[model samples]
Target: MELFGQSGNFVLINIVSGNIDFDLRDDNPAPCENIWVGNSSTAPTDGECI
Candidate 1:
């Protein structure tokens, strides 16, 4: 686990919502989602995003 990093793509579990989250898309950096929903592959971040 890395979170909200400047590079790399990976998924981590969000225990609060019981979903997986990612901070990279298409190999680019993205806002790390601490809370998410939906499938792990396409998990979507919801309220209180960071």
Candidate 2:
């Protein structure tokens, strides 16, 4: 799956899996302001994409 759009916010629920991975990319490659990833019950405090 992929996401493409302008600035906005979103929430995901019951997204359970093993060894999940996230990648953020842009055609112009602008700096990413913020991103959050975690388990189904709680939010992640810290993580790195690259």
Candidate 3:
């Protein structure tokens, strides 16, 4: 379980809606969603879809 990201502000939401919730602290980076959505080679990020 590992996510790579730079230091900044981000908003996490459940795309399906009302199924999941996410909150990432400034000290803790978020995992890239690329593993679940895009191809395994793309390396998705929390900011990609936005």
Candidate 4:
């Protein structure tokens, strides 16, 4: 997942909360932008990527 001018590459696992956490990576790279990933059940108030 490569976002424009942003690195969205990473694996998500053992996620217990809606916070951002990555367990593996090629390097401790800079985080991606404040992007948003929402579903149909997602609310607008929950803002930012979760």
Specify the highest-lDDT model's number: 1
Model 2 spans > 4 angstroms off: 1-3, 10-15, 18-30, 40-50
Query: Model 1, range 1-50, lDDT digits (tens) per residue?
Result: 33344333333453433346643223233454332333233455332323
List the candidates ranked by lDDT, beginning with the highest.
1, 2, 4, 3
lDDT for predicted candidate 4 compared with the true structure:
0.33
lDDT (Cα, tens digit) per residue for candidate 4, span 2-39: 33444443334323333344322123234544333332
Q: All candidates: CA RMSD in angstroms?
A: 9.3, 6.9, 11.0, 9.7
Q: What tens digits encode model 2's per-residue C-alpha lDDT throughout 1-50?
A: 22355333333333533433433322222354234344352223223321
Taken over the whole model, the C-alpha lDDT of each candidate is: 0.36, 0.33, 0.31, 0.33
Residue range with the least summed lDDT across 10 consecutive positions in model 2: 41-50
Residue pairs whose backbone atoms clash in candidate 3: none
TM-score of each: 0.17, 0.22, 0.16, 0.17
Candidate 4 vs. true structure, TM-score: 0.17
Please provide, for model 3 over 1-50, each residue's C-alpha lDDT reduced to its tens digit, 9 standing for 90 to 100. Answer: 22355434334343432223322112333443332332222222233333
Off by over 4 Å in 1: 1-5, 17-50
